[model samples]
Target: MGKSQKKRSMRRHNPMRVPDSHLPKGLAAASESSSKTEAILPIIQKMQGADAAERKWACVAVSNLIQNDPSTRRLLQGKNIVGTLITRLTDSEEEVVVEAAGALRNLCIDGGYDICAEMYNKSILVPLQTFVPKLSTTLSQYLDDQKTAPENAQKLVYEFANNVITLLWCLSETSNKALNAINQLQLVPFLISFLGARQKIPLATVTAAAQCLYVLSDDNPPAIADLRADGGYIACLLSILQEPPQDEADPRTGTLRVLAAGILRNVAPLPPPSVASALDLDAEIVLPQLTPLLSISLTEVSETALQLLGSAPETEKPKDSGLKNTPKSDHKSPAEVGLERLENRLRTVQLALEILTGACATLPDPQPDVLIDDEDDDEEGDENSDDNPDADMATPEEAVPDSREQTQSLPSLVTPLLQLIQPTTLSFPPLAAPSPHPPTTSALSAIHLAAFECLNNIFLTLARDRHANAADVGAVWDAIWTALGLVGTQTGLGQEQRRAVWEAATGVLWGVATVSRGIVEPKPEQVQALMALCDGATADAQLRVKCIGTLEALAQNPAFVDANATIAVYLLSMLPSANGPSPAGTEPMLQAASSLIDIYSDEDAPWDINFRSGGYLARLQGSVDGIKTAVRAIDRRKEGGKELRRRGEEVRDNLVAFIKYRKDLGL
Candidate 1:
């Protein structure tokens, strides 16, 4: 025992100095046991010399009494108490140091800056920092130290580390400077290295590091690169990704998605790797694995992957520079075939989708029990005993792979991953409505965004190979229309969210125009719907602009040009000066007119239809009465409503010019 512990034990048991109240409660309560010699200070001093059993009894008594009284804990704050505890940290008696570390941990709890500063001043934090690394080295040398020696010792140290981390978390939460300290410590790196240690510690440490990285990287993109450099954050994260997924019912996949998003978003616009090798570990190795993750059930994952994918092959711009098309130049070499290699990529993606779809279908169903024998029971012997050093603290090779092997493809990864993300038939529980009533149809908004992205990929694929997957293209179009319709309804979506949905819908429209244009038909019903939408767009500035673009694409279709004379007349009237103020509305009508003019003026299909002859000319003549009627009604309004009068007159002038030109051109 340490000399100070020896002195303290003597003082508590000495016949000359000990008080009756100082007697241990258990000893005092015992009716048959009355050994006065054991109560004397000199006699108690002998207790320390008696044997390991006697010393254990004294240690237990001291621990109990100190815990029972708040005053006893406060008394330990004396300078001598601090020095004594530090001494035991290096003591040969394993029991002594373990108890001492425990006491120090409690003392540090909820401690103020002054106490922490004092600890720092005493070099306490340094020693605690060394404990983890030191534990590794000492495990072999100190295997036979005490009665439950190694386990108890590790428990004490783990508890101590846990307490320290708790304090650090509190500090990080309250002070940005403290968080900076943690990042500077490269604690993330430390935790990863120590993943070879106990599972709980690494889990706790890495999770904290993840949280810290999350806060540090928010909004600032370059910080992500810095974080990656800190002990290969990207590599460690990739390791997590390569690891086999837990069985279904586990939520870690969601957690992984969240962490991956934070890291990927931060590292956005990944710089060209410093190396120039063809099998660039950063690109070829990283991109293939990550591309598949774009199909994960999390929207954030797809979003992150989208951003990251844009960063690949920084050397060249892909043929389709816009968002929807896969960049043919994403790969560095001709063998990669850029966009041309999409067929092979699609096959790979299809395989993953099929697996994921099946897994989602079966994951939620309960299965029969099949328990395996308990192998961990023997390993965990007695947690309080430090004696079998090899017991629980020994590193397991299977826990994590070596740095080299970690780069290799994982086994059963796809199947397990699919099981975790299997989709279920979603229930559209009520959301706040225009009135408090049940919704008529369920929405797919609740489906994981990863799944949605997978569907998006499917759309892109089917759209690319329209001749082969015509039915799939049609089905995707129907689903897209349904999704847009659901989003358009007032099912409690806020304005911003609604705007986003509209934006996505417009994106889908653009995709269809580019990838599946051959499938669009200018059916009368479709044309009528398009016209009504044009009217609506004419009224709303935003919708007007978007509809104008869509309509222009529709005008390109030979089907529309072949069947409809009205389509040409429609284009002729929207020329800045259009047939009297379009009764439909201003913005949509003006935008539609603007678009139609552009379409007819195109080299391929010049405007040739006569607006003042045949069925087309009669249609224009019939529309004048409606314009005059609306103008007269506007003229009767308050005197201040003259703006509407001016607009109405302008519309009339444009209509007259359009008619005159058509009449001059013989149909």
Candidate 2:
């Protein structure tokens, strides 16, 4: 060979080669790509082989390759290895089936929607459904013949069952198509049966089965129905939860508890029958067990506790004595770790608030007017029979029964919720020293919003039940005001976060105002805070509308009519003009305007001086003109535009009526 050719050959066959990282970016990428490609073809060929052992080894090799490497996963997906695996799921050899199942489950680790869709299209669920029941039956038989069964026979059964169920859980999360397909196969009932037969089944198998049920029935009504039909499923889950973990190192305990709690969260929000069934279960015992889990440092445990409690819990934090004085290593600082823990805790609290909202679904409908039929002759006759005109407008206290005295006393969830909103003294150094970041502030805001939501639910429930005493109502009101002030001071937060805080603050304010209508008097600071929220230019329009609505609710109390007169003028100024943005804003604007008119027309309203000085009448005239102009500006041809015009016209007519009523009263 020539000298130049010999040099090139020597470079290609060098004993020591340059690492990819040391090479140019493009060269490194190309070399890594070439390596993955080189590995894919051999694995694919081996997986397609007729020999069970070769195919099984190929499955294991592919599984290891794609375990954590996204690039390898995509490469394998392109090579149709999943198709090979799915075919192997039905292999005659049990070892090959187990290996293929494990491989597919690994592929789905973080596969997300695309991988799940591909699996569904490849008819993966068919073999999974067929194999699951057969495997389950075989496992049961093995359990029955425990004395004569092979040593590893039970372990093998558990491995196969867990792999299939875990894969199903992944697929179900990808899309409704996979969920619906699985539901159609009627595996949910079978899965619940497995859970119910807890002592007979392996713990790992039971945990997998519970997780599968959680995924399948999450928001799907049909799956929920199948579980609810047995009625004993809830009891079975509770029993599993009540059993203490075998030891501290038992990993399966946490998984089983979380899954069981998740299933309850899903089932608790179903129709009345399902909710009633759940409510009848032993919450007294279940809640105490769940409350302690909230303070467990693990995010999964706390999150599940929040889910199960559904706006409920309390217990001391668990001590991790082993790690307390451990030597430091190359890892995140204490501040960073604390921030993560705080974020997770805030998320858990947020989930609890969500559950609280769901719990309200079972309460009696608070709005009695909706149920009253105006067309019924008897109802109309009864209304006419009342000689006192004011009798028809009786307060909620007089109209509704005091059911709180007779109903069961609910757990006190407010104490812990209030504690969460209270600012904590961070033991670690502040995160803002070196550079400012939002993780801490954002987490605080989330906690605040969650606390506000829980407070709102609590007050609403109290109002509906008519059980709230003066002290309880006062405590809730004070907490809401404090939360509002905190949100107001947080100018550094993002607009979206601030907007959420404002929305939640207004909701809590509205709920308190609603529940305390007749019992508690409005404070000036409370009125001023609400006014500031409505008048703030940067405030979200929805929040502004809600604040105005709350003010209107408070105006119903005679003691606050004079204070609300200025609020009425502000409401009039906020009326939508012809050139205003967002047509959707019209509805709430109209509602506010109507509420203002209601306030001003009240008998005790100090309308004489306030109306003259505030230009209230002229503002109403302007509002009517502006709305009419907006109506005319809308295109009459399109359905949406026509509807907008109709609403605008209705608002204008209402404004005109208010003006005429005041004029007739000689105000």
Candidate 3:
């Protein structure tokens, strides 16, 4: 081995141990503490203080404290802690309430409504929902005074709503409590009210409301009906469409957009077509608004518009001029305005269609063509050129050009969105530019979020429909992966946003693995491309976490296991030690070693040829070489193979037993 290789090889095998300073204090303490509840409640109480920022810190502390402590089960048994925390919902400081709300959310993350009810008993749920009206009133008055509120009242309300939504999601399985909470808040209306505000509300408010509706619709149809009964279903969704995103497009908007799409999709197929729709939702009203939205030049809005259109039924035929005819507008076309370039105009039309059609994977039937005989075309063209040529226009069949087949690999829908989101500067640069207007970081963020939302919808459609076009899938993936590369850029994104981006990208990556089965070879090149972007040299913590997550997912897939195994091994080997016994040379290794090992082990492992047979096993065995190398390294010095193996075997046995138990129970 060379010096670098030899050094790496010779390094002590350390199990992954993240640094204490790196970890949230509450989480670290909770992990190390002998008594789980004993270590956590005080931190949880601290979050109930009056100082919003202080409480925010306390919330973080509480979230961390619960990080690895499933043993706190008994402490949570009676909901005493939940009840205590909920009382802080009415704290004077919004941040304090936000933190307390967040803490309550964490408690119910796994325990569900049992925990939520305990919180509700403290009257937290009522305040949590009621706070929105108060904030709305406060915000309206403040806007009238033209004074920006010192506290982020909008953000506070959103956080409160988020906590409630999360809690309801957990409790949704119990007592129709989730449904009750949504109805009580009439959250859809509260969220829609913010759509017209001049002051920017955090994107979280809209997203939370949307997600709650989504869960409710999925869990209970009656809940969706009730939401509709409140007289704001379409209005709420449309209001979100109307709102201008912050400079950095918030992921919350993207989330809300997705939820809205899901809502439309869920409601679209089953609702009876009516002469007058239940909500007076004429395509006339929606379509005109959509036309302007399509031209706003933001990818997220475009994507969202496409999703809405996709969900909307095609109710009436066009009023002549076909799809290409531009609506009457002040800005004349290139020809009318004396600036028309045929190719450029075509591109604009394509983009407009892309936005309006909801990123349609399948093209409509080709338009009628006016056949032209080239040999005799000069005489006919000369005659036609004298007439109103633009009126008689060449159809897409004639105008798209011979190069379209070659250039159209990327869907027309996603390619433009990707272009908009692509960062001009790869690394941070000196503030040298003196342009009249500079792009704000918020705008850039908004673009990224918009791109992600579009891609998510496209992927979901592909998964659900199965008949979704492959070229469309490929094009969408190409654009999504390109944007995904920017997730770790030093200056472009915040830590929280970056994490969200990574998580969103993970969903796409996971979909690629899951959806591509039997159709294509798990393209190793694609995985490698993602791996490279995700594994930056500076090693941003969020990037590494997301990278590890994506890598773990890739390694689990049988088809990709062999192709991606080496990269997986490389990533796993970099797992930081969990203990602070640092002999670390480079940045202290993150404490992800155990997670890596656990990922590779298991009786259901892709390489477990005992159950799998034929060429599949052979392919899996090829991938086994890399996993085995890492296993050996763990065995040699880390002493972690035993724990991993034990955990893996335990999981495998449980799965098998569960299968047997399910069979017996006929469940």
Q: What would the TM-scores of all predictions be? A: 0.38, 0.58, 0.35
Candidate 3 structure quality by residue, lDDT tens digits, 453-506: 444444433443443443444454565566656555333212344544554565
Predicted candidate 1 versus true structure: per-residue lDDT over 507-613, tens digit per residue: 34533443455456545654554455555444354454454455555556655554335555554354332345554454334444444434434333432342223
Give, for candidate 2, the lowest lDDT window spanning 10 residues.
1-10
Q: How close is candidate 1 to the true structure, as a TM-score?
A: 0.38
State the weakest 10-residue window (summed lDDT) of model 3. 1-10
Better lDDT candidate (1, 3): 3
Which number leads on lDDT? 2
Stretches off by above 4 angstroms in model 3 are 1-60, 63-83, 90-95, 106-177, 180-186, 195-200, 227-236, 242-249, 269-667
Candidate 1: regions farther than 4 A off:
1-219, 245-249, 253-475, 485-488, 491-499, 522-544, 562-594, 603-667
State the C-alpha lDDT per candidate. 0.39, 0.58, 0.43
Cα RMSDs, all models: 28.3, 15.3, 24.4
RMSD in angstroms between candidate 1 and the native structure over all alpha carbons: 28.3
Candidate 1 CA-lDDT value: 0.39
TM-score of 2: 0.58
Question: Which candidate leads the pack in TM-score?
Answer: 2
